[model samples]
Target: MGKSRHEKRAAIREHKEARRDRCESDAYLDANSRVIKAERNIPWWRR
Candidate 1:
């Protein structure tokens, strides 16, 4: 069965949190800004 709206929203929230944590870890490890932005799916104009 398909997930309900609330379930889908929760999943999205969890994914965002996970990505944020990864970005922070990458920053701590001296990962490139471009690479971190790419992971967060940020575009050029947004920067």
Candidate 2:
């Protein structure tokens, strides 16, 4: 009924990879992204 050792290690690796992706996504959408989107709305003449 128990998982084998390889299955346990694979599960741990998947968990760590998911956690890393979450952290990266949070960092990716900070003030920089906000500024970029805001900039798109302005005409070239305005800037």
Candidate 3:
């Protein structure tokens, strides 16, 4: 199943927090953000 609303929000929030922390490398953050986008767009049934 696709991510639930709570899961999606959590993932987005986690990514935002990571960006704010500035601890991880830019490449890592960029890749993570891309993953969020990819997962977020998936249809529930398809997931």
In the range 1-47, model 3's lDDT, one tens digit per residue, is: 89999999999999999877786788878999999899989998988
Q: Using Cα atoms with residue i matched to residue i, what is each candidate's TM-score against the true structure?
A: 0.53, 0.52, 0.45
**Can you tell me which runs of candidate 1 are displaced by over 4 Å?**
26-47
| Candidate 1 per-residue lDDT over residues 1-47, each given as its tens digit | 99999999999999999988987786665667667767687666887
| Decoy 3 TM-score against native | 0.45
Give residue 8's error in model 1 in angstroms: 0.1
* lDDT (Cα) of model 2: 0.89
Q: Count the backbone clashes (under 3 Å) in each candidate.
A: 0, 0, 0
Residue 16 lDDT in candidate 3: 97
TM-score of 1: 0.53
Q: Give stretches of model 2 more than 4 Å off.
A: 26-47
Between candidates 1 and 3, the lDDT winner: 3
**Candidate 2 vs candidate 3, lDDT winner:** 3
Q: Cα lDDT of all candidates, in order?
A: 0.82, 0.89, 0.91
